[model samples]
Target chain A: MKIVFIFLISILSVAAQLTLMPHLSFLAATPNLILASVLAWAIWRPEDKKEWFILIPILLFDLVAGQPFGLITLSLCLVFFCLEELGLIIFKQNDLPAVFSLTFLGIVLFELFQVLLSRLFAVWHLMEPIRLTAFYFYGSLPFNLLLNGALSLLFLWALNKSKIFQNNGPLAKLK
Target chain B: MKDIDKSKWIKFFIVLAVILLLIFFNFRGLLSAPKSWALFAASPFLKLFQVMDKGVSGSWAFFLAIKDLNKENAGLKSENQFLFEEVTRLKEVARENELLRQQIGIGQAEQQRLVMAEVIGYNPTLGQYILIDKGAKDGITVDLAVVAANNFLVGRVAEVNANFSKVLLISDSDSLVNAITQDTRISGVVKGNHGLGVLMEMIPIDAQVAVGETVLTSGLNETIAKNLIVGRVEEVIKKESDIFQSATIKAAVEFDKLEQVFILFP
Candidate 1:
């Protein structure tokens, strides 16, 4: 039942990401809700094997909106693992600051991985090469990081207030 | 601890293997069936969210406009009276023009067959695209021209499934349309500026371009029709050292707010 609920939430997130988020753009980039939600879920329920659960939306997003499939899934999966390792090493406590840091690093690595893989795909004659313009690094990235960071923090706060972290949930044990 | 590390490595390999398999299937065109089925199931949800978005945005816009409602209402009444007279005159002129064309044996230069489609989704990533309800079943194909009201150029169909298609907005980095200034007839190629806006480039340095000149498709591209309004020149950039000049275009169609569009059939 939990798996099914996650699956449904993933579908709604993808749909909202597509239909609604574009209208809410700041600095020509919209906040990545799926990325923020996944990162927050990882921190909130780390023991539940949430990394694998995160792949549900990742796959749906890839199928629906991704061009040249597997780029997003590959980048995000690697980002997920990196976040896990970082959480274990540094952020032993799942605090709000830790959420911000993890989200910022996750978004940065996501962009880096996508750029590198897209170049590789171009070399293999699978797609056209994307030019790394100055606007991307200087203009868009800062706004994207800011938006995702705020969103992830918001999601974490909501999770903290919700029942999932209270009675009959995993975080109840911690409390 | 050592066993935990080993298990983590195993999970990583499992992810990598699954991604590789999916990539192979995607590139081989084997994933389209499942993808279509998934999208077909999700289309209703997309449309529902679209309606919700529209209601929210519409209410927000109304709230913003409320402060100036009285002044704008008074001004619009006068403007509407003038426009009513102007429209009556134009209707008569159009009727005369139709008779003259009939006498000249020119039955309309072109009869465009347009299939109307409702927007269902948008691209979630950086690339600019909108998903529509019409698809191959409705005769939508790659490179077909999509337009909004007043014959404003939107973009072309980039991909199609059985029940849906993706329209690459004119603001997409990969989009290019051959266009010209409507009055001066100075030719240029209009391309997207990283999804932020559109830019018309490759104009001869000597061409006398001005701000606010209307840009139209040149019909140089076979897929897109001629004289469709792309945008107006908002700013001009000319450099002494550069071989060609370029101008920033304000697109007539708001790519973000599009709800319905007509796909042109050739």
Candidate 2:
């Protein structure tokens, strides 16, 4: 069932890339659905011992997209673990602040991670124009937050409707 | 409970094995291995996706056709007038050369090798990269310059395979080119600012840099030919106590509208 969910998320991410987000760029920023989905899964199933599932899509993203290897994987893992710990505190409720804060942190960390890796690799000079980086971060922050927040809520909603949120075991009780 | 624990370990082992295989392939650089089989397997689905995207773009284009047609018509009329004037100017130059007994130096340089390529697809996940139809077999190599119509430098080849090559646009974060002002001879490095625009850095603070000046490649590296059209200076920035000024460049080539490019062979 987790495998099926991962496949569905992958298809949705590809579809979003092809259709919904074509030419929708905020200064070079686009919606990161794969990142969002992986975060969602990490938060949804914190105790599943299936961290590799999160790593799979990230590896595929790096491979198919031609980014430096392990870049997205590293970022996603960091975001996943951070959010998974945060998820422990907020697990009882699906409130707006919890969702928005987590999504916002995800975006910030993802961008920071990319910049840090690029700097460490000597891909681009650091201390270049801060305006460009500032514009991209401030410009895309709200939209990314909203998009990821909606996705997180939707995932939580689905799990709740399916009774997975109420179950404390590996398998959710069927309705 | 013991059986459940055993099953969990088995599942974990399977997942771990898959991850290990992926990591091995990634480190080996085999993740980008020839995609002949995968392309064959996924062709049908890709075709469907293409059709859907085309349908969406087509509908939008249809709605805006009238406005676009009028703009195109106006552009063509001015271009025709400019061409007529250019023809007369060329004729005058030829006549003067004949009268002065001076040899016309036309066609003395090495033959220009151009390979025409179509951009069949782009990776949306990778915002600053594009794939062209021509590849290593066609003499495309890493760092080869790519230009659009009217000889505007668009990007350089970043990755090459048998039949396809990827061009990294100037808008990418990693792109940096040595460029100079066409009018003032002021030199600087044009670096991609990732999102807002490209910035020309390290220009001496005393240089008379102005907005709207044309920037061209300096050919300092011998990788990009001299005087290639890079961009137009949009803004000049000066900070107090700084020894150098930076300028923002508006790239001449619009990367978003790119459909075809000419890859220049070394």
Candidate 3:
């Protein structure tokens, strides 16, 4: 049942990405639907189970729609583990500001890792790095944060309203 | 319990080692991994987005149709007419020069290979690539020069697949071309500035470079044909202390409006 729910979430996220959020590009940046969905799942689940379930969609995302080799899988795994470790304290005092800050930081970290890996692997040249301006980083940060936060909240609310999250485990109780 | 912990660490190390090996082979171009599958899968989604963009642009065009576009079109037509006439006159002079040179026993040039292609799409993420219809099957190879209808050098083939090729425009940060001033015989390398223009570098500061002077490919690498028009010098920036001067060039082809191109095969 949990596996089915996770699969449903992945489909929903892909659908949303294809429809409503297609035009919302920040220069060369696109909204990372897979990352946002996994982050949402992690925030709503137990630590150990979170990593395992998150890895499934992430690897699927990587296989179906990602660059060569393990770029997306590695990057998404890193982000998931980092967020899971911080989820205990962060979720305890969750607010709009906290969510926004975490989303922004996650985006920055992901982009930084992408640049580093591309350079180190010679996939992209070191001389011509993608410019990360304050305007670019901070400007769209709020809007994306609100967008992801709202989507996560809606999913959580839907789970609770349907009581599908009940009787699963302690992680489902959080949902 | 101790053995289970050791096995977990071993699994982790193995995964890490595999990832590193993949990255190494991917960079060397030895592996034909499914990198472009992501783009292929996302293309349907992109098509939907393009429809939205077209709708928005269509509405904008409707509003501008009444007054602005007509006026702009008129101005553009007149300017184009003047430039077309000037090019005709220049062609006549070039023909006469060729005849005179032939009479003086000048050698004949090699036949150039030209392949006409259409622009299919632009990669939004790379900002530096223009996808052309021709690819490996069309005899398109990496480093092959791409030109416009007017015989102006536009870019070069960077990445090629079975049915499509990516052209790296002259405005991309990674692009470099060996060029020479047609009138002055000054030679230099043109490097892209990731913007609207290119910079001709390594020209001696004292070289006879002036605004409006035409630049052409030197064909030093044999990748591009010699004497293919690239652009005209727009501005010359000279540094007294340095041996070389950098000059800005106005590319002959307007990249933003490019819809068609021709790839010259080796």
Candidate 4:
């Protein structure tokens, strides 16, 4: 049931990203909501078995988002796990700062990966170096981060309400 | 317990290795098969969301839109009245011209056909493009010129699938069209500057090009018809010691509000 719920959210996020978010863009950039969903889910430590399922939605996103296969999947897997492990050591569970910060770092690294990979894969026009990094960062980054922060809060609330992973304490280990 | 831990580590490495290898090699072709099927299935849901989005966003846009519409409606009405008078005058002139042409043993002008399509959605990449419902099945070929109301130049067909095609907006960084100033007849290359409207360049420095002058297609490339309205020159850039001058054009068609287009079959 938990997997199904996350999957549905991922589907909706992808659909919304493609269709509706353009209407909500600030400076021609929309928040990377799917990436935020992964980070938001990673904010809490889930059961070891359930944690692996996070990759499924990201993989689906890679397929549907018209990006190179496995680019985001690979990026999300490494970043999600890194945040999960880093959060375990650096901050306690439900810690908004850790989720927000790691999500911030995740978006930066994810965009870097997108640029580097787009160049390597020839998916983008190669006539000039992609200024997408600057374009993404100029005004879009702050907006994306704020939007992702809000989404993380919403997911955190929903996760706590579901009681899928009981919160004994902020630092309580899930495994 | 130690032995079990070592085995688990080895299992982890193996799994990670396989996944990495799969990613290292491109499986996009293999994966895109399922993706196309999924997109095909989701097309209806996407369309539904598009409509729903308009309703939600349109509420805010509607009022602001009404004011602009009123201004445009007034402008268009006056233009229409002037055009009506001009057409009535030109009809007699055309009749006389046709009689002269018949006397000279010349032929009638060829009629061009156009295919109309509604914009279904906008492309969600850094590049500026819009998707329309016309495609090869609709006789919409790649590179065909797309125009909006009043036969104003909007864009060109960049890519075409079976049932849909992508139109590269004239504001995209990659777009270039041959254009001329309507009053001065000064020809230049109008290049897209991403989101910044088009820039017309290669005019001789001494040539006269004025702000507010209308721009039209030169049709030197044999692709589109001549005299299709491109935009109005908003600003002119001239520099001392430079051989050429350029002007920035404000496209007559509002791309953000683009809803329908016609594919000019030249």
Q: Return the top candidate by lDDT.
A: 1
**Candidate 3 lDDT over residue span B31-123, tens digit each:** 333434433544455456446655775687788786788788999999899999999999999899889889998866566778898664453
TM-scores for all candidates? 0.88, 0.73, 0.65, 0.72
lDDT of 2 at A79: 70
List the candidate numbers ranked by lDDT, top first. 1, 4, 2, 3
User: What are the clashing pairs of model 3?
Assistant: none
Return whichever of 2 and 3 wins on DockQ: 2
Query: Candidate 3: misplaced stretches above 4 Å?
Result: A1-77, A88-92, A123-175, B1-55, B58-74, B97-109, B117-120, B124-127, B182-185, B195-197, B203-214, B232-245, B248-258
Q: Model 4: per-residue lDDT, tens digit, A1-175?
A: 5556555656666667656766765555555666767777777665543566666667655555533355566666666666665675666554666666776776666667665655654653322334554555666566766776576667767776766655453323433
Task: Put down candidate 4 lDDT per residue, B190-248, tens digits, no spaces.
Answer: 87764546889898899999899999999985677888899999999999889999999
Cα lDDT for residue B142, candidate 2: 80
- What C-alpha lDDT, on a 0 to 100 scale, does residue A1 get in candidate 1? 68
lDDT of 4: 0.70
Candidate 1 local Cα displacement, residue A62, angstroms:
1.7
Superposition error at B5 for model 2 (Å): 13
lDDT of each candidate versus the true structure:
0.84, 0.65, 0.65, 0.70
Worst 10 residues of 1 chain B by lDDT: B119-128
Q: Is the docking of candidate 2 incorrect, acceptable, medium or high quality?
A: incorrect
lDDT of 1 by residue, B1-266 (tens): 88987899899999899999998998787887767876876777898998888899999999999999999999999989998998999999999999999999888867889999988887736578898888878888889999998899999998777777888888887788999998899999999888889999999999999899999999888899998999999999999999899999999998888889999887
Number of the top DockQ candidate: 1
Interface RMSD of 3: 6.0
Q: Can you write out model 2's per-residue Cα lDDT over A35-137, one digit (the tens) per residue?
A: 6676566556433345565664565445444444455565666677667656655554646676667666766666676556556534432122223346555
